[model samples]
Target: MKSYDDKHIKNIVLVGAPKSGKTTLSETMLFEAGIISKRGTIEEKNTVSDYHEIELERGNSVYATLLHTEWKDYKINIIDTPGLEDFIGEVIAAIRVADTAVVLLNAQYGVEVSTEILWEYIDRYRKPTILAVNQLDTELASFTKAVEDARRAFGNNVTLMQYPVNQGPGFNAIIDLLKMTMYRFPKDGGKPEKLPIPEEEREKAEQLHNELVEKAAENDDTLMELYFEKGSLDEDELREGIQKGMLQHQVFPVFCLSARNNMGSGRLMGFIDNVAPAAIDVPAEHTADGKEVAIDPAGPTGIFVFKTLVEPHIGRLSFFKVIAGEVKAGMELTNFANNTTERISQLFIADGKNRNTADRLRAGDIGCTLKLKNTRTNDTLGDKHFPGPIAALEFPSPKVRVAVEPQNKGDDEKLSEVLAEIHLEDPTLLVEFNRELKQVILHGQGELHLLVTKWRLENIYKMPVVFLPARIPYRETIQKPAQASYRHKKQSGGAGQFGEVYLAIEPWYDGMPPYKDHPVRDSEEITLSWGGKLVFNNCIVGGAIDSRFLPAILKGVMEKMQEGPLTGSYVRDIRVSVYDGKMHPVDSNEISFKIAGMMAFRDAFHQAAPQLLEPVYDLEATAPDTMMGDIMSELQSHRSIITGMDAANGNQVIKARIPQAEIDKLFAALRNVTQGKAKIKAEFADYAPVPADLQKKLSENYKETVAV
Candidate 1:
C-alpha cells in the first residue's frame, strides 16, 4: 500500500521444501512487525500469504504472494512462494525480484526436494541468502543436526548467524552471534525479553562466535587480519563483513527460528535488515537487448513483467520489476517483444488480493499495471527506442499431461476462453488442442499441479471439467519392400477418365544414402529431406502415362504417407519408387492419377513389412543410494535400460531410456515406488520400433481398423 525507495526496502523471499514453514514464517514476521493485530494459523486458513481458497484447502502455497511490512523504518517486501515441485515457476518468479532468499528448513526434517531445488535457483541468481531453520519447537527439532544438514546440503557456504540456545520445549532463547546477546522468550506467552548470555552456554556461544569470525574474515583481507590479530572482531566490523560476504555468495548466514510459535521472528527481521543487500549492492542487470543498465532513477524508464494474475471481475494484472529509471501513471512504455506501446494507465503495488494505486515506481521496485495491451509475463517495458526485454525465467518441463473437457456442454466456450486467461496468468501451466487425438490437453509439473489448475477452472471460472489419461502418440511405418499397382477408370463421365500406377514400398533404414544421410543430431526426430534420392524413375517407355500427371501422383503419395499403411498415424522414413504407369490420351487427368497413386501405395504398403514406432524418452532420476536398486528395477519394469549412473551428493543419479507411454501418470507411480523420495525428469529422445511381440499385435490391430 505504501512505496519505499530502494534505500529503505529489504526484498527477502521465503523459499524451501513443502511443509517447511515458509508461510508460517511469513505470518510470524508480519505479526512480529506489528503489521497484523493477530496471527492466523494456516490450519484456520487465516494466514495473510496463503489467503487463496485453494491454498487454504491444500495448506500449501500454489503461487507466490507478496506482503510488505515496515520494521525499524525499513520496508521489508516478503515474498511467500509455493514449495511444492509442481509450482516451481512461482518460486522462480519471486526469486527474480528479491534481493535475498530466506530458505526455511524444517528443523526436524532438515532438507527435502523442494529445499534442494530452491538452493539451486538461489544459487543461479547469486543473490544474498540466509537459512532460517524453522519449527524448532516441534517434537523432532534439533538445531545442531539441522545445522549439519544445511552444511551438507549447501556445502561449506552455509555458516551460522545464530544458533538456538535450547531445543523443543526447552527452546526459550537464541544466541545472536553478531550482537553476542541472547533474546529469551517470555514463558507466559508474551514478547521475548533481551538478556545477557547465560554462563553455561557462553563457552559454546563463543566457539560459534569464533567460527562466524573465521567465515566472515573470508569476505575481506582487512577483516581477516583484524580477526587474526585480536582473535575477535567488533559488531560493526563483523556486520560489514557479513553483508559483503553474503552479497558475494562467499558465506551464507544461517538463522534459527520457530515460526509457528512466533519465536525469534523479531531477530529474523533484524538480521534481514543488517545482512540483506540493497538495490545498489546487486550488480547492474542487462536488458534482453544486451545493454547493461543500472537501477537508475534518472534513466529512461524500463520494467520487466515477472508475473501476471487474472481476476474474475478485475482485468489482467501484470507484475513488473523496474530495472532502469522510473515509471509513472499515464506514462507509456514500449513492449519490445510485441513492438507495441502500452500506456501505464495506473500503477499499483500488490498486497495479496488487493492492490493500492501508486503514482509512480522507481527502479528495483515491483509494481502492478492494469490492462496493458500486448504485455505479458517476461516482457520488458521501456522507451520506444529502448524497449528493454528481460530474460524469461526458466521453468521445468511439464511431467504430467491429461486431456480435459468441460463437464457441462454449455460451458465449453466459457471454459476454453477462461482457461486461456488463466494460462496467461501462470505460464507454467499449459493448454493445447490435439487435433489428431481430438482432445484438449493440459500439461503441468505433476498431478497436483493439474488438479489445482482444474480446481481453479471450476471455482474461479465457474466451469466444471473432466480429465482423461493422455494417449501416447504411436506412429506407423513399413519394414520390407513390396510392389503393387492400381488402375482408375471412369467411363460414365463425359470426359471418361483413365489412369494407372505401379509403386514399390520399402523399409526405411539407417546408413542408406538418402534416408540415413539425413542430419542426425542430438534431438528427437531426424530431419527428412524432400526428393533426396528415392529414384522414382517414371519408366513409361511409351506415351502410356502423361508427363503432367507426375506431380499429381507425387501429391497423392505424400497424402497417403501421412496416414500410414498400418496404423492411422503419420508414417515416416519410407521410400516409394513409382517406376511405371499407364495413361489415356484424353482421360489421364490429375484426379484420376491421384486416386490411382493413392490406391497403389495402399496396396504395396500392406504387403511390405509394416511396424509401429513408439516414442521414447531420456529419463534421469536422482535418489538416495538405498533406493537406487528400486529405481533401477522400476525402470526395468517399464521396459527401460539404464544408460548410465553416477554418485551425486550421496545420492544416485540414474539415467535410462523409456517409452513415453509407460511414463504417462508417472508421478503417481514414482510416489508409490519411492515413497516420495525419488524425482525424475524426462525429454523426448527418439522414435524406435516397438518390440517384436508388441509390434505383431499392434500391426494386426492396425490392419483390422483399416480393413476395406
Candidate 2:
C-alpha cells in the first residue's frame, strides 16, 4: 500500500433508515473499487459491513463497520453505520468524524421516520452531504416522488444530478446530468459503458443539465458571473462550482442507484472521489477549552479515537483519525484524558473483519491500533509537548430502562464485569446499580437495544440475565408540623442506659426561621446524605442536654430520614428542634441520645401529614399529525399534563410532564400507537406529590414488602 497525502483522502459515512440498503450499497462500492471480488447481500448474511453474529442473526446492522478502498487515485474511507434507532450512537460517532455523509433514501418510501431522525444529526454536524435514492429497480420505486420528498424535507437546495433512464425491472442505465452522458450497465451490473444521451431522452436530460449548472453557479460569485456571460458552465467549471457548493451546503446533489444489482454505483463512486471534501477541507476541530487544532502534517501529533471494538483473542482495537501530523508504528503519544503515555505498537487499516497492516497513518486517514493502556472512545492522543484535548462526542441520553438481574443468583459479580466491558464498547448502554431500589438497572435506546444486550450477555458472557420492571424512585415528605417526645431506658447488666427527648418537627421552607416565637440561637442547617435539607435548632439553654450530645441526636434523626417511617423511601424537606430532654449521668451516652432522637423523630413524622412524591419527567414526542391525537390520548390516560404543542417538519411536537411510573414501557407503547413513526425523549423534571389513593396503595405495598 502507498501512503497518500491529506488531499488524496476522502472520509464518508453511509446513513439512513433501516432496510435503506446501506450495507448493500457499501458492499457494492467495495466490489466496484476492486476491494472485494464479489458483492454480498444482507439476505446471504455475508456482507462485510454487517459481520457480527448478532447482526447476522437479526439481518440488520448493530454496529458501525470501517472499510477503505482506492478509486481513481483517491483513498475513500467508508464508515457503514446502523440505521435502526436503537443503534443511533453508531451513526452519531461516524458523522462526528467524517467530512461527508451519503444519506441513502428508499426510492419507494422516500423520507421515512428514521431518515428524518438521522437528518437532524447530519444538519447538526453540518457535513457536506450527497443524497442517494436507492432500490430504483424495485417494482414500487418512484424516482420523481423520492426527489420531491427529498426537496420537501431538506428544502429546495436538493438538485437532481442523475436519474434512471429506464427504472423498475429494466433499470440498467442512468442519465448523468452533470456530465451530460448516459451510463449503461451490463445485465450482470459491474462496470458501466459511457455513451451519448439517446435522442429521445436528450430533451429532458438537457433541461436537467441546465438546472444543475444553474444550481452550481448560484453558490459562487465568480461562477455566477461566468454563467451569466456564457449562459452555461463548462465541464471543469461545473465540477469546481458543485464541489464548492457542496462544502458550503448550498447545493445537495441527488443521485440514483440500485445497490443490490450494482447498477450506477461506479459513477457514484467517481463523483465522490472527484467531488467529496477531504478531512483537511473540513473546519478545524476545537478543544474543550475552545482551542482550534488544524489538520497539518507538520503540526503536533494528534489522533482522536472515535470508536472502540473488542475483538476476540485480540484485545481492544482503537479506531482513530489522525487530525495533526502523522502517527507511525512505535511512536509514543500522551493520552490527554488520563495523562498517561501509550506506545503505539502497530497500525492497521480495517476492512470489515480483516485488517491490512500499515507502517504509518498520515493526517486525515483512519486506522486502528491494538492494546492501549488508557485510551478509549472520544479520547485524544497527542504529542506530550503539544497536549491539546479535543472535546468528546455528545450522545443522546438513554430513553428506555429495565431492571436486570442474574438468573443464576451467583453470577452477580460476573454480570457487573461483563456490563462494564460492554459499556466500554457502547456508551449508550448505561448500567446503574441503585442501592435504595435494590436493583441493577440497564438503560438503553429501546426494546430491541436491550434485547440485543441480553442476547450478548447470555451468549458471549455465558451468563443468563432477566429483565424486570424497574422500580420508581419515590420520595417521602411531610405537609404539616407536629410535636412528640420519647424516652429510652434500658437497664442491662451493670450501668443503665436512659435518655428522654422532646422535639418539634415542621415542614422546612425557604426563608422560614427555626421557630415562630423563638429567636435564632445556635441553629445548624446541613444537607442530608440522600437529598434535601435538615435544619436542626439547638434551643437547649442552660445545658438541658449537653451540647456535645446535639450531634448524636442529629445523627439519629438523619438515620430515620434515610428510611422514612411511612414508607422505606428517603424523606426530605423537614426541620427538627430539641427544646427539652432528660439524661442520667451514668447512662447519658451517645447510644442513649441516639435512640431517643430516633424514636421521637419517628413519632413526630407519623403525626405530621406525610405524603408520597414520585419523580416526573419532561416528555417530548415527535410524530406525524395523523398519530398525534393517539399519542396525546395515551399520555393523558397515564396522568400526563400536556404543556405545549407545535408543528415542525410536517410533524407534531407534543410536550408534556408525566410520572416516571407511568412510562415504564412508554417507548414500546408509543411505537405501537404510531406504527413506529413516532420518537420520544424524556428527562427528569421534578418530584410531585402522588394522588392520595395511589399514595395509600404504595404505602401498603411497601409495608407488605418490608414485612415479607
Candidate 3:
C-alpha cells in the first residue's frame, strides 16, 4: 500500500445503528480506491473493520476500526465504530478526533435507537454530518420513508442530495439531483459510468433538483437572484452554496447506496471530495492558553490522542488526530496534560489489522504512534512552549460493576500494575480500590466491556484473573441520642494506669445527606461548641479526675468512632462530648483513657437508635409505551419506585429510584424485556434506612461471615 502525507487528509467517522452496513461501506470504498484487491464481506468474516476475533464470532463490531484510503487525490481516514450501546465509548473516542460524521441508516429499519444516540453525539460536538441510507436494494427499502425519518429525528435541516432510481431486485443506479447526472455501475467493482437521468425517473429527479437549487439559493443572495431570474443556477454556484450550507449545519445532505455491490461508492466518494471540509477549512481550535490555532498542513504540530489499543503482539498503539501542524517519525512532543516530553516513532495509518507507514502527518489527519512511555488517550502532544490539550468528549460513567482478582497468588502485585496501565489506555474502564469492602472493583459500560478487559488481562499481560459480583459499600448511622461512661484500671507495671471517659451519641438530622454530597471522602470530625463553659462540667469542686488526662480521654473517643460499635463500619454524623472523666494521677496514661473511650462508645451506640443506611440509585429508563407496563412491572420487582414518567421519541421514559443492590443485573433484565431496545442511565443517589427486619438479617449475616 502506498502512503500519503497529511496535506490531503480528511477524517470521517462512520456511525449508525447495528446492521446498518457501515463495515460494508468501508470495504466497498477501499476496493473502489484500489486500496484492496477484493472486497471482504461481513458474512464471510473477512471484513477489515470487524477483524477482531470477538467481532468475527459475534458478527458485529465491538470496537472502532481505523482505515485509510486514497481517493481523488485525498487521503481519507475512516473510523468504523460499534453501534451497540455497550461499545458507545468506541464511538465517542472516534468522534473526538473526527472532523465529520457519516451516520448510516438501514433502509428497512429507518432510524433506530443507536442512530438517534449517535446523531445526538454529533450534535453535541457541532460537527458536520451526512446521512447515508444503506441497503437500498433490500426488499423492504424505502428511500422516501428513510428521508422522512431522518427529517423527523433531526428536524427539517435534513436534505436529500441523491436518490435511488429503483427499488429491490431492480436497483441499478443512483441519480445526483444537484449535478443533474446519473451514475450506473455493474455488479462487480469498477469505475462508474456517468449517463443521462433515466427517462422514467427524470420527473422525480427534476423535482428534487428544483428543491436542491432553491435551498442552495437561499444560502447565497446572488444565486437566489440568478435562480429567480433564470429559473436555474450554475453548477459551481450551486456546489459552493451547498458546501457552505453543509459547513454551517444549515443543511444535512442524504445519500443512498448498496455497499455490498459497490454501487454508488464512487459517487459517495465524489460527494466527500466536494463537500467535506479540508484541514484549512475546519474551524480554528482553541488551545488551553485561549489562543486560537489554525488547522493547516503547514502549522505547528498538535496531535490529540483520541484512542489507544493494547494489542497482544503490538504492545500499546495510540491513534491521534493532527489538529494543527505536522508530525514526523523520531520527533519529540510534550504532553500538555503532564508536561512530559515523548519521542514519536514509526507513524502508521491503520486499516484494521493492516497498517501503512507514513513519513509525516499534517493537520486534519489521523495516524498512529507506537511505544510512547507516558502519552495516553486524551493526552495532547505539541510544542512545550504552547502545549494544549484537546477538549475531551463527554462520556457516560460506567454503570456496571464486577470484582476482579488475580488467579495466581503472586500475580496480585503484577495485576495492579497491569490494570493501571489498562485504565490509562481507556479512561472509561474504571478500576477503583474499595478500602472499606476490601475489594478491587472494575466498572465499565456493560458486561462485554468488562469481559474485554478480562480478555486483555489474560492475552496482553499474561495474567489470569477471576471476576465476581462486587459487594455494595454500605454505612452505619444512629437515629437517637444516648450517653454512656466506662473506666479502665491496670496495676501490673511500675506505673499503674487508670482513666475514665464519658461520651454521647445522637442521630444526624442535618438537611443534606452526608455521604451523598461527598461520595468518596472519608469520615470527617465535626466539633460543636456549647459556649465553651465546661460543657461536660462534673460540678465536683474536689477534682475527681486529673485535668491532665483530659487529652487522653478525647483521643480515646476518636478511636471508638473509627471502630464502629455495631458492625465495624465507620461510624459517622453522631456527636460525642468527653464531658466528665476520672483519672488516677499516678497510674493514668494514654492507654487507660483509650480503653475507657472504646468501652464508652460501645455502650452509648446501643442506647442510640443505630440503623444501616442502604444506598439508592437514580434511574432513567426509556422504552416504548406499549412496553412501559412490562418495564414498570420489572422495576417493581427490583424494589423500585417511579418518581416521574414522560414522553420522548415515541417512547415513555420512566424516572425512578431503586436500591443499588436490587438492580445488580438490570442490564440483562432490561434487554430481555425490551429486546435490547431500551436505554437506561443511572447515578448514585441518596441513601435510605433499611427496614428493621432486613437490617437485622444483614447485621447477623455480616457477623456470621466475619466469624467465618
lDDT of each: 0.80, 0.89, 0.79
Q: Where does model 3 exceed 4 Å of error?
A: 1-7, 182-200, 384-387, 491-493, 511-557
Model 1 worst lDDT window (10 residues) = 515-524
**Candidate 2: worst 10 consecutive residues by lDDT?**
512-521
Candidate 3 clashing pairs, residues 3+ apart or interchain: 299-325, 300-325, 496-587
Q: Can you list the residue pairs that collide in candidate 2?
A: none
Residue-level lDDT for 439 in candidate 3: 88
Query: Could you give candidate 3's per-residue lDDT for residues 551-659 as a string of tens digits?
Result: 5655666565555655666666665555567877578787887789778878888888888777899999886677888888889888888999999876689999988
On residues 448-565, what C-alpha lDDT tens digit does candidate 2 reach at each position? 9999999988887778989899998888889999999999999978998888888989998888854954444688888866668889988777667888888889989989988888
Candidate whose TM-score is highest: 2
Q: Over the full model, what C-alpha lDDT does candidate 2 score relative to the true structure?
A: 0.89
TM-score of 2: 0.95
- Residue pairs in clash, model 1: 479-609, 480-609, 544-583
Which of candidates 1 and 3 reaches a greater lDDT? 1
Instruction: Give the C-alpha miss distance for residue 680 in model 2, angstroms.
Output: 1.0
- TM of each candidate vs. truth: 0.93, 0.95, 0.91
